[model samples]
Target: MTTAPTPVPSSAAADRDSTRVGGGAGGSRTAPKNPLADRTAPRRRLRPAGGPWLATLPLLVFFAIAFGLPAIAIAIGAFTLSPDAPSGAGSFTTSNMTASVQGAYSTALLGSIKLSALTALIGVLVGLPLAQAVVTSRFRMMREAVLSASGVLANFGGVPLAFAFVATLGNAGELTKQFKLTSHGWSLYTFNGLTIVYLYFLIPLMILTITPALEGLRVQWREAASNNGATNWQYWRHVALPILLPSLLGGYVMLFGSAFAAYATAAAMVGASIPLIPLHIADALSGNVLVGQGNVALALSLDMIVVAAIVMAVYLPLQRRSARWLS
Candidate 1:
């Protein structure tokens, strides 16, 4: 006597049917997409900021006005027959570049390179040991003092530096007067003297460059080597120097650049008498002797830039390697 069960329209039954329709075979219902939802609301991600670029804009503009324009002028003038003329096909020629290798400019370029190479070698030899000592020293105060002095001395170049050396070692200088070095056959205006003077800044610059490399040598590496029965000399030769070699080479390149491009100290001390490229460049700019040799100076500058590019190509990789060990 069972009548057919009356179907009850309950909330739970409706929900069950909805879940079965929307969900997968597991009967787990996920949230349904709402067409009316405001996805354009504040909950959406914000746009990236331009604030950092704004801070750098002034520096970029300054570089454009100063270094960028001068560099562009150098390039244009290097290719042109006349720096005074507008750069175009009509003004274009390779004579300036060709002339650079042909005349006194050739002598100057070679002399500058020779001077730079000599100074860089001396700088590295003297600075490397000093840096090592500072890094390994027990006294913190002494290290800091040496580092501070190195920083100051490295920047202390140009006319004042030349004058300081002159005051100490020039023919009429205090030391010269006191010791009578001139009578004993010492001269301050010669190549050897100039190199000696260059060492004042070069050694300090190298110290500043190489100190961090010395500091970066890991104590654990030394301990491991010692445990493996490596002697001090063997450890340095095989373990430490190999790691530091790149940094040393990079620092040497920098020292070479510093000496090569130096102007004021050479200008004030040796003047136009010295056959150095910087002096040649200066003479060209001033037109003291040559009436219109600005083009030649531009060519010389281009040559310098090319050499710099080559140095950087070598230095950058070494510098990266040094930085990795330090980091």
Candidate 2:
């Protein structure tokens, strides 16, 4: 009977009674917060609602000014009536383009295409071996020198390179005089001569662009192939060529574009003797006659747009394919 003398509830029990809260059976109703919800709530509060668009503003402005404005101006100029034939005002016409396609312009365009193709082909053929040599050579100093020279030569464009070629191989060039060669005998102003000069620039660009692709072939992969009894040619043909094709094609397109858009070199070397598109466009802009010349410029601009489009059409897919393999 004295076992507990009636167990008295403690103050804690009294406090629980006052609050009416407990985990035991028959406790009063109370909602518990979800653990996941509590964790995610802070993250939602901390997140920014709008900020990424501000980062893209600069790029949009750049494209609008650099590309968009120029394109619109050229397009407008192309359609505007020439001062010489200003009867029709602000109307579109294809007569200027049609006329160009008939005479020396057509011939020059064809020559340009043929020359560019040949230049790209020769550049690749020559550059691939040189690039391979530079990359695989054990002579570090020589390789560095060659690579540096190639970088410098690649950017040696416009008037300076043209003048150098003239001074070295022109009718009265230093090299020609040193060798007693005749100007008419070794004219660097002809189509073939221009192609060779273009190749000078094209080869360096090819080397610069392709060396990286060749270098990207991991040494371990080559070693693995060799350990499996693969020959060097077999290793390159089976493993290397497939991966390199995309980059090579992309480089070819760039070389083609460079050769196509070349104006200063061709102008300096051939001048009015050659009817390259860029020369024609420049003449149209600078010539005394103004009216129909604007249309001709427009047509040339259109041609440039076409060339650019074609290049992109070819380049973008190759780039994507290359990226896929790289990834």
Candidate 3:
């Protein structure tokens, strides 16, 4: 070991110096790059998230086929001039709409509005109390029974409901026979009679709709009012009525729409004597009364849709206000 002190090679000494610093060309080591994060491939931006419509794709497609196409055809047909004339000869015009708002057609629409309004009014007057009674009852069985009945009756519309009413109150119906209603100037086919029949369903529907809102009335609110020396009448008039008003109005609008759109029941019970819009629509479509006014039928449908849209516009705001308490 002492022999010449083991002389080291110059190149190997320089290599050791470089290793003491860093193993790079200029002794400046570069940072290691991440294979994933430092990727050179251009990043692909993500697409915007889709809406919830994918979940309703099937329903959308079904409506497109069932309702959408039919609605478009009706709109086109309504504007089509001389719809009764041969195809390719017809052109677009608003004459059908003009005709719809004139003469008997206008009367029919007004009649429909009257019937719907009367039914809705009566339904509210009768049904609100009935709903309140049921919801506020201490007897659970009675509440269940009434609610159950309402559920069934609300859906029990259309032809069969009409027939049932006829059998019970028609000219030769059991009630008519027993009570001799016809002799008392009460016929089951008049506008008033149709109104009576409509109540059978409309009242139940109101009961079903308003019951929840009635239940939403907190007992504590009444108690608080009582503690403040407020009478029951005062509490209801000031506090409860305001809260319930929106729900009541909303229910009335719903009933109006239901009655307005009703066809099969009215048709079965009274034919066309009532001059209801639905009856007029039927006549325009098939009967020789309107003859070649099929476009008028479609025009009438458009008017109905417009009315429905207006009803909903009024209903939505009322519903929003009601939901503040009842939801």
lDDT ranking from best candidate downward: 1, 3, 2
In TM-score terms, candidate 3 sits at 0.79
Q: Which window of 10 residues has the lowest lDDT sum in candidate 3?
A: 40-49
lDDT of 1 at 321: 82
Name the candidate that leads on lDDT. Answer: 1
Residue 255 displacement (Å), model 1: 1.0
Would you list the clashing residue pairs of candidate 1?
none
For model 2, residues 228-288, the per-residue Cα lDDT tens digits are 9999999989988888889888888888888888888999888877667787778777863
Compute each candidate's TM-score over C-alphas. 0.80, 0.79, 0.79
Off by over 4 Å in 2: 1-54, 288-291
Compose the digit string of candidate 1's lDDT tens values, residues 217-266: 89999999999999999999998898898999988899999999999999
lDDT (0 to 1) per candidate: 0.88, 0.81, 0.87
Order the numbered candidates by TM-score, best leading.
Answer: 1, 3, 2
Clashes of each: 0, 4, 0
- State the local distance difference test value for candidate 3: 0.87
RMSD of 1: 6.8
